[model samples]
Target: MKYNKTYIFGITLVATLGGLLFGYDTAVISGAEKSIEAYLIRPLGLNSLIHGATVSSALIGCVAGGMLSGLFSNRFGRKKTLLISAILFFLSALGSGFPETLFFTKGEPSIGLLLAFNLYRIIGGVGVGLASAVSPMYISEISPAGIRGRLVSFNQFAIIFGMLVVYFVNWSIAYGQTIEWINDIGWRYMFASEAIPAALFGILLFMVPETPRYLVLSNRDEKARTVLTRINADRLRAESILFEIKQSIGRVTERSSIYSYGKVVIFIGILLSVFQQFVGINVALYYAPRIFESMGAAKDASMLQTIIMGFVNVIFTVVAILTVDKWGRKPLLITGSIGMAIGMFAISWLAYNEIIGISTLVFIIIYTASFMMSWGPICWVLISEIFPNKIRGQAVAIAVTAQWAANYLISSTYPAMMEYSGALTYGFYGLMALLSALFVWKMVPETKGKSLEEIERLWKK
Candidate 1:
């Protein structure tokens, strides 16, 4: 099939805005964590438990959003579901930024206030979950089979780009602020920064066409044909795509059951999602500032380093986009898992031996780089490709929801773990990385050049 570079790029960019919001919403909290805890939790006399809840409230929304994506995307179409997600992101940003005004009393922090703030965060979290599940699915469905791996990877690139932008924004805002200033006012601005990108996402989302698969499912044959023609620029190829979509939708409608595949595929999908989070990628992305602080760095220095990590994440994700199709998904996952394991082990050793210096930071950069080039993007690619078309949306939703839950678990527990075990916590992450390598080797099938139909057949075999 001939590809229309302009159409592909345009649609990919719009769909990838979902990734941008995903990154912005998830990582923005890192910048605000210290400040929020200091000003709101400490001054309000909240305990650590409530503090943790405040931090993880968005994650709860993520799981809910992920689970709902299947239903919404299946029912309302991918484009509309994404529109709803954008709305949620906008509201969450506004609500989270001014929770005191929205739901809390002035100059007071209580469980009630914290709950309200978390509720807002959860709304955004739901957006993240929906975006995470739907963005790549949208990209995968629209992308040409030959270039699908690379195009789908653009979603990850956007995510890292979003993370990088937020880190810079956070650093710039907090650059010269004293702890008092940051604790009092800086965090509010940090969260409010998301409103800019969220608005951009909403506007851009309206510009993209609905997925052809969605169009065909709704019996909008002429619209589907038009979209396919624009994407492939060939009448024959466009009709072929429409035919495939029809077959897939027919199978799904005929089954009329979400659990048509029984247990094994669901288990694999859920495990893939769970492992992606269990490896603690977000612990690094979400808490890099705090981790650096624990290594004896100042707040400003930590924020700067976090920005650097975000930069590295973006660069490596781009590299993954360039190389995923050529290198194949399994190889990248294997290499990433091994590299992460080694990096994590090295960081653990450095911290455990009281080597609180540049070496520890260097190891972290290596870890983040390895992950970005491998599991960070590759996992999403695999998830979008591995499931059959008939059940892909539902299966991917389950996996993504599991991922957010795992992410919440890691992020919520890290503070306590650091307080207790410090380096040992990293050692545990290292071990999980190693196990991830084993899992990839044993279970993950390479789907580099195959079409989605071909991959589904291979998996069924």
Candidate 2:
């Protein structure tokens, strides 16, 4: 059977725009967070908690969006749910940039305007939540069995690429600018830059066909057969594949719930999502510049360091894509977790000693790269593959919602944690990383080189 490589790649690329926007909206605030604190929080008589809340406000919407994903994706299909996410992304970007245009004067800080700004950021968060769950699921459903891990990993690549792009964008916006200007206007431009790609994602999404698995679920067998033919480029192979999918669906009765799939599978999925966030990955991302600044680097230099970290992230995510299917999931995850534990433990030592210099940077790079290569991408891949098809949408929604909720807890508490003891904070993450290695070893089943339906059968066993 000949493969339609270009056509499949094009469709995968389009679906990954959801991932690109996910990374963009989430990390854009990293560069602008301090400026936001200066302009909005301090002037309005707020404290660190409110500043943290405002910075992480999008996570609240993420929880809502993730919780709603099953209903939305199941009812509307993956492509349309992504379209809705893109619309939300577009609106959030513009609204966050000019939050005061409708209700308040420019440059005048008010509680009302502050509320409006958070509202917009949260809208963007909702978009992130939707994309985080649906994008990989969409990719997995369309991908061939042989290279599904590599292909779905492209979404992670897009995610890291998006983060790297925004890091550069944010740095460019702040470069050669005075602090006052960055506070008053530069941050707004940083927020607004996301609008361009958000619009692009929304546009291209219409060009891609719905996943064949989705078509099968909708009982459109002929349409499913057509899409599968194009993707597989073999009518006979497509029909066989379609039959297998139908067989899987037949096993699912209308009364099936998430538990019907298997308790262990759902537990593993939820735990995977939780451990991914609890290891403090997002804290590193959302507060990248601040972490660097705490190491005695100047503001601009800190942003520069953030860009460097973003670059490392992209490079290592590519490594993950190249090696995931080849090396298998367990080796990469366990290896990466060990690396993270080492880097974080070293950072904790340095922080306690008040030694902030080359060593700190090197350790931070190591930690970020380790995550990019392992848990960062592999976790998503497993989540997309592990659940039974009958319960995938709902199971993924529950796991992702837990993920965002954990993200909010870790990220929102980071400031206070840092203030109290940077040593303890980093040391704690290091411990989680070590524990994560053990958890993966004990609980996670490797899904490499398996069809989605085949992998689903593991839980039933």
Candidate 3:
């Protein structure tokens, strides 16, 4: 059947905006973290633990958001849940930028003010959690099997693009500013910048239809058929596809049994989410500037290096988007795992030898690029595809919540871990990379070119 390419991509673009905001809110901290450390923690004589917690406070919200996503997406439908997330993003950006609105004076460094800032960030994290889980699910549901991998992969592309944009935005805000000015005001602007995209995402979300699979779940068959017809561009094909979805979904209330597909699918989904974070990708993302600065680059140069890394990420992620359907998921994931291992192990050796130079930078790019090509996007794809319709919502929430919790543990502990030993820290991630390769090779089933119903049957088998 001929799919409506224009209609498919048009709504896909809207769905991906959720992904863009997820990246924007998550990475915006990269630029503002040091200033947060300087302004919020230092004056209070807080240690690195507090500093790390303050920086990673959003992950706490992410866990909550992830935990809640299944319920919200199930109840509200994917499009409306994303709309909710966009609203949260907007409020978080403004509040995080001017947390004093919560009634604490700026520069006071009171515990209350710190709490307020983290609160706003957590609110945003919830948005990221919802978007992260629902965006890919939405894309996967609406996409045709032939192009689903590529379309769902675009969510990852949007995410990386958003991070890159924020990295550039942050850099622009601080390019000519003095340290005092940056610490005092530049960080606020960096955070406030997110509101623009957040607003855009919220506004555009209204233009897209809810996923047909979701409409089926809601018992809105006519609406589902209408959406499917537009997306498939073949009335008969759409009807057939709709029937297949109903057969797979089989009474939405009855399908929600989390273990209805058996324990293996859930376990694999959880493993994918956990391994993604354990490889220390978030460390590179959240602390790029600090890592570069520690390697002796000036502040501006560190930010510039981050932009370069972001560029590489964009390029490699595009490679993944183009090849995910062609190369297949397992090949890409296993290959990426090996590449990431090599990158991290090399960085570990460099740190062990106290070697700080261009090599360290090269390896960091290699590590992030390897991730961008593989686990970064593939993990989300698998989670969105692996479960049966009977259990997708709760299962995705469980997987994603586990993911954010793992992210919190890894990211929040990095500072103390660094203090103990940077070499060991990186070496540990390298070990995870190797293990991830083994896991994918041994367990993960490839879903390339398979319809969501076909995947549900595969899991049932």
Candidate 4:
């Protein structure tokens, strides 16, 4: 059946906005962490540990979001769940930007106000959490099998692009300001910038239809046929696709348990999520400027360096999107894992010798580029593809939840680990990267060129 490529692209673009917000909400903290530490932490006489907790508090909400995504998405539909996330994103952005405005006196320091700020950030994290799981799933279900990988990879591109956008916004905000001024007010503007995109996503989401799969699941066959024909451009082909979806789903009362798809499929999905985070990419993202400063780059120089890294991330993610369908998933994952291992190991060695120069920067770029190309995008593509439709909702929730938990564990423990030993801290991530390569090589099935229904049959074979 012939389909309208432009129409498909437009839907994909709108869905990936959720991905952009996911990236924006999470990485926005990188630029604001120092200000937060100065304004919220130091004022309260808190230590680095508390600062780490504060920085990662949003991830706690992420876990809750992921845990609840299956139930909410199953009940409310993906579009509505995403709409809910958009509202959360908007409110969190405004609240985080002006935490002291509501209750505390302006410029006054207190633990209560800090808690309020963390609460707002956590609310945004919940949005990130929901978007992270639902965005890719939505794209995958809607996209054609031939180009699904490419379309879903766009979500990853959006994630990195969002990070890049915020990096620029953060740098621009602080480009000429004194540290005193930046800490005083510049950070708030950085956080506030996200509100524009959040509002846009919410408004545009209303324009797109609910996914055909969800409509079919809910017994809205007429609506499902409408969406499918719009996407497929041939009523006969749309009906054929709908028939396949219905056959796969069976009766609604016959819902499969989480492990019904076969333990290997579920395990692989969880590991894909886990390894994506355990590779320590978030550490690079969440602390890009600080990592540079630790290498003796001044604050401004570190922001520039972080911006450079953000560009590298965006470029490599584009490479992944272009090649994911052509090159297949396992190859990219394995190759990227090897690249990350080498990069991480080299960085660990340099950090151990206290080498801070272009060499360290080069390795950081290599590591980030590898991740952006491989685990960064492919992991989401696979998770969205691997699960059987019946179990996809709950299964994705579990995998996404594990991913956020792993993200929090690695991100939260990073400062303490670095304090213990820079060599060991990065070396650990390097080791995980190596293991990730082996995991993909041994466990992950090749998913390219297979429809979601086709992929599900692999478990039985």
Candidate 5:
């Protein structure tokens, strides 16, 4: 079958925009942390609990969004649902950025005001959640089987790119500013910057066609044929592709227990999702600045270091994209898990002994690099590819919801945990990393270059 490079690249870009939004939303909060703590906790007199809740509000939305994306995408078409997610992203950015002004902030501790801000963050979180589940799914469905892993990996690449961009934006905004100036206005600008990408995402959504699987599922055969033709570039192959989708849909519907698959698949998917988070990658990404601060760097220096971490993340994600097909998924997971465990153990020892110098930074960079090349991008690629078409949407949704919930738990608890046991936290994550390696060794199969049908057959057998 002849491949249309232009169509593939265009669709990949649209789907990957969700990654951009994900990266922007996730990392944008880092810059706002100091200002948010100052205004709400220090000056406004809110306690640590409330301040922490406020900070992690977006994650709550992420869980809810991920939980619902499967249902929404199944009911609406993927393209429409993505457009709806874009709307949510735009609103969340605006609401989160100017919460006090958008809603009614009477003075200091207004319950309504707090809830309002959190609600906005949740709205954006939902967008992230939907994108997380669907973007790769969309990419997977549309891509040629031979190149599916590499193309779907573009989603993770976009996410890391987004993270890197925001880090640079954050650093530039706070570059020469004093603590007072940063606390006063700089953070708000950081949150507001999300609006640019959010708008871009919305515009791009219109330019892409709906997934052919989705159109076929909805019985819009002509539209599905058209999409398949444009995407696949051969009438005969397009019809065959459409027929395959129909067969999958028919098999799924014939089962009286389609919903039960969600239960079993969701359990596995959620565990994989949760384990990924519990491994504590975000603790490194989200709190890099604070972690550097703990290592005796000034705020500006710490922010600069966080940017460096982002750069490392981007570079290694490229490495993963190149090698994921060549090396296969299982080996990457095993290698990453081992590397992460070792890196974490070393960092824990450094922090535990108060080895305050360049060595500590070097180790953290190694840890981040290890993650980007393996679990960071490859996990999403595997999840996107491994599930059967019958339960792919629902299963992936469950996994993503579990991931966000785990992310919230890890992010929210980290501060207090650090206060109580700094080195112990790293030790705990290192242990999890070792366990992750064992899990992969025992359960994960190599899915490189296999079609979805082939993967499903191998798993069922």
Candidate 6:
């Protein structure tokens, strides 16, 4: 039966907005961190401790959000939980931009104002955490198996596209502006800019239907049938799919334990999340300008180079979306791991010899492009669809929780590691990249073209 391509795409786009906000929230700091330090940190005479905490405070919220996602998602439906996240995003954007609103006087930074700012960031982090886990899960549950990889992969594309969008927004907001103006006034606008998309996401979400899988699991069979029918355009085909979903669990119960499928499935999901971060992708993203500066590129040139890298990331992610179903998950992951390792090792060698030039740029692009094509998107693809339906929300929460934790651990430690040795720093990430390939090659299942029910049965073995 022919699927309703237009209808399926419409909802998928709405879901991916969550991904866009996730990227925007995380990377928006890169543009505003210096200003945050200047406005909030210096005025209060706080040391680097306060400055670092203020800049990365969102991760604290992210950890809490990821930890709580399973509970929220299981108790509430996915759509409502996502709607909650959209609200969080909107509030965080406004609160982060105007922490002094209706309370502290403007331009007067006190310890209270500093704490208030961190609180707002943590709120946004919670939104990032929820969106990070739920967006892909929602996409996977709705998408047909044949095209599921591409559709879910689009969420990652949205994430990268979001970061790129923020990068441009930050640049435009700062360009030709005085540093004092930027610190005093411009940074607020950068944080506030996210409100537009968050409000848009919240409003648009109401127009899309809850996923059929979620509807079925919640025992709303008739509603599930309707959604599936709309997606499939053939009532009989929709009925068949609904029957498979019902048969998979024999009932609608999200209360089944995460260990219901045994520990291996959960472990695989967690490692996929960990490896995706431990390979040092976020380091490249969160510190692109810093990394380029370390290579002696001027400030302006580094920003331009970062933008160029963002373009490369988007292009390569598209490659993954196009090829993931056709090439299979394992192949692309393995090929990309090798590409990342070679790129990282090349950079390590160059750093060892104290080399900095266009070759460094080339290798960095190679490493990042490889990541965007493989682990960047494929990890989320696997995590979303890997677990049995009964335990998906719980499993994804645990996995995503580990992901945010590992992200914080890796990203925070990069500066210290680089101080110890740039060569060794990249060498370690390169080694992790190689091990990720081995992990995928041996353990990660190739989920290409398999229905969620079909894939679930594999764990029963």
Question: Model 4, 1-461: lDDT tens per residue?
Answer: 48879888999999999999999999999999999999899989998889999999899989989998998888999999999999999999998998886585675668888988999999998998899999999999998899999999999999999999999999999988998999989989999999999999999999998998888888898999999898989999899989989988883346578877668888888999999999999999999999999998999899999999989998999999899999999999999999999999999999999998999999999999999999999999999989988888899999999999999999999989899999999999999999999999999999999988899888757
Q: Model 6 residue 446 lDDT? A: 89
TM-score of each: 0.97, 0.99, 0.99, 0.98, 0.95, 0.96
List candidate 2 segments past 4 Å from native. 102-107
lDDT of each: 0.86, 0.92, 0.93, 0.92, 0.82, 0.89
For model 2 the local lDDT of residue 327 reads 96
Badly placed stretches (over 4 Å) of model 3 are 104-107, 251-255
* Candidate 2: 10-residue stretch with minimal lDDT: 101-110
Residue 305 deviation, candidate 3, in Å?
0.4
Candidate 6 stretches greater than 4 Å from native = 42-50, 251-255
Error of 1 at 97 (Å): 1.1
lDDT by residue (tens digit), candidate 1, 166-186: 998888888877878887788
- lDDT value for model 6: 0.89
Ranking by lDDT: 3, 2, 4, 6, 1, 5
lDDT of 5 by residue, 184-279 (tens): 678777888888888989998988998887787778989989998988889998888888778767776766353533454445556667768887
lDDT of 3 at 137: 91
RMSD each, Å? 1.5, 1.0, 1.0, 1.1, 1.8, 1.7
Ten contiguous residues with the weakest lDDT in model 6: 249-258
